[model samples]
Target: MSFTGTLDKCKACDKTVYFVDLLSVDGITYHKACFRCSHCKGTLAMSSYSSMDGVLYCKPHFEQLFKESGNFSKNFQTSKIFN
Candidate 1:
């Protein structure tokens, strides 16, 4: 099959995304407007963000969630002391 098109579906909205309006992260493509922090619903167009299990989050929210889940360790200070 020969395919020659520059269209992809936005991972968030499942809508068509043209090449010019596409934003890619971690090999997933989203419409520029659809790329947002899943927690706060904030736009992530020009800021640092993280993705977990296919969901996007801003740095602050990412850290907050991890901290709340007890997955974020503050033991770095203790490790430093031991070293």
Candidate 2:
């Protein structure tokens, strides 16, 4: 049997994300609503967000948790891949 309607899943909510609700970051994907700051739970957008490893966070929280490094998460890299 072939699999159906269950290819991609959200890293945060662990729910299947349809194309319409999909929000991809780096290589990982999430439901648009599920994509939020890890600490504050604030909403995140494509252009202005930060990440650690594969975890998502708003810029402020990123700096707060990771400290004001000017450029957050060097090892994992920040969310600067938008183009």
Candidate 3:
């Protein structure tokens, strides 16, 4: 009994994601349609997003939150791993 295929649960919809439709970030996997900004509910498929405390946010919202928390810095650098 050997399992050959990979399946992951979508964090938002709590559904199983097949390998072909899976989108992962930082180790968590989600279905393509389940990936969106946690704040504004904007689509992140082709945009920059940031994850904090297991929540996803679009770049602008992430920056705003960081600024409000007094954590914004001029020397801040975001690693570009996803395109």
Candidate 4:
């Protein structure tokens, strides 16, 4: 019998992250399909995304949640936005 040693899991789904469909961001790995907006459950692209406190959000949701009246959040959470 053959064994595939230790598997890497997707943080969102808690499922195995196969090498072929891996999408890693900010040191975290996910399945290409698992890379989605946390708030709206919408699909996201590697080219554009917003990450806050390790959670991912689509552009609109991120703006709605973090942006307020032309003002930004008070550094409550470190964000890494790729757009």
Q: Which candidate has the top score in TM-score?
A: 1
Candidate 3 has its poorest 10 consecutive residues by lDDT at 72-81
Show the colliding residue pairs in model 1: none
Better of 2 and 4 by TM-score: 4
Comparing 1 and 2 by lDDT, which wins?
A: 2
Per-model TM against the reference: 0.73, 0.70, 0.69, 0.71
> How many pairs of residues in model 1 come into backbone collision?
0
Worst 10 residues of 2 by lDDT: 68-77
User: Tens-digit lDDT track for model 4 on 1-83?
Assistant: 97573388889888888788888899898999989997678999976688877878888877876654344442334466689
Q: Write model 1 residue lDDT over 1-83, tens digit each, in one string.
A: 86455668899998888877888887898988899997788989546887777878888888887766667432212222343
Clash counts for all predictions: 0, 0, 0, 0
Residue 61 of model 1: what lDDT? 81
Ranking by TM-score: 1, 4, 2, 3
